[model samples]
Target: MNLRTFTAVLFALTLPAPPAVAEVGLSPFAGFRMSSSVDIETAGASADDQIHFRDSPSQGLALNFDLAEPGKQGELYFSRQSTSARLDNGLFAPGIESIDLTIYQLQFGGLYFPGGKSYGGFVSGVLGVTRLEPEDSRYDSHHRAALSLGGGYQFFLTEQLRLRLDLRGVYTALNSGGSVFCSGGCELRFRSDGYLQVEAGAGFVMRF
Candidate 1:
């Protein structure tokens, strides 16, 4: 080979390699929710009532796309809980009796790892809306701004799968004096700060 051709080939080989292709992870998780409740003031009643939601099971799925940065991923999260709610007040109220409710959280967010490892711990934050739906035909669904702060560690089980244990503190916004689940027959007025709940979940993350 000619000297010039050899030198050109050598320079091309010395160039740095490109970054590795990113990965995607899908996780279907199941867990429990704690301390879910809301305070309400009935429209035509003198006393305020508390609606207490029972602690129940929650299941969800999360889809994550790896970013250009190592250990960073964009996440789409969704969760649902079907449970019952009862009145805390002793007096009989006309509206919202023996309420069976379904709650959902749909969010978009990201996760960050300080250690920058796939098998290590990471923190996540999600911003979205909390949807509270009643089984009763008279009441309509309610949607409110919500957020969650969470973190967890992933345990490596195989090259294609890992186990993740996660915990999150969720907050749903309830602006004071806002009416919810309103229809001609029954309505509820919210009072107090907001609604707060905690979740603990474990799931398998499949990577591709």
Candidate 2:
């Protein structure tokens, strides 16, 4: 499929479910994510063609406010998650060994429990802003809008604590400030200039 068609399909597939009710609750969450592609695309190459960039396997924390009704459809939530990464060139290279990233996201979406059982699962989508902290010697730091789609399950462990497993594919743009390109090469950043991330983490939810 073409790029536009593929992107459209992806977004459609990731749309959030409608909320079940109109209620609000606060929860804290944490998770881990692994990068499937480079955070910054080179000036003249596609993410699929590049190598040597450091990959990230990160830990994250989030605070979520879910709003919806009780015991019916689904619930929408507003949440922010933060994670960082350090690039490693892996060859004793002095200049490109590390780049730290602290990503912040604000998402408004909801989750569903298809059958309404004691233990259930859900899916969600989040659109928000992300901030990247580049290494001192590499590219400049940047902030951009990001989109995410993922899902998780909730497990009740006690009267006050519920465990959750969440995951997503996050999309963010590449910084083009000082991008370089060969005399005859394409402008490094392609039309599809973002990376994909798959993350999983454990969090807890409480009812009061």
Best by TM-score: 1
Model 2 misplaced stretches (Cα beyond 4 Å):
1-24, 39-57, 64-94, 116-119, 135-139, 174-191
Q: Which candidate is the best by lDDT?
A: 1
lDDT of 2 by residue, 1-208 (tens): 9999999999999999764532333456555655654533444443423322233345444444433433232333333334434332231123433344455555444555565432368666767766655434344455667777877777877544567778777776654443422123324342346667666666666544
- Per-candidate local distance difference test: 0.84, 0.51
Q: Candidate 1 on 1-208: residue-level lDDT in tens?
A: 9999999999999999875543888999999999667888877656688878889999999998888888888999999999877778733236436678899999999998787766679999999999989888666788899999999988988766889899999999997778766667455678866888999999999988
What TM-score would every model get versus the actual structure? 0.83, 0.58
Candidate 2: clashing pairs of residues: 20-74, 21-68, 21-69, 22-68, 22-69, 23-68, 31-201, 43-188, 44-188
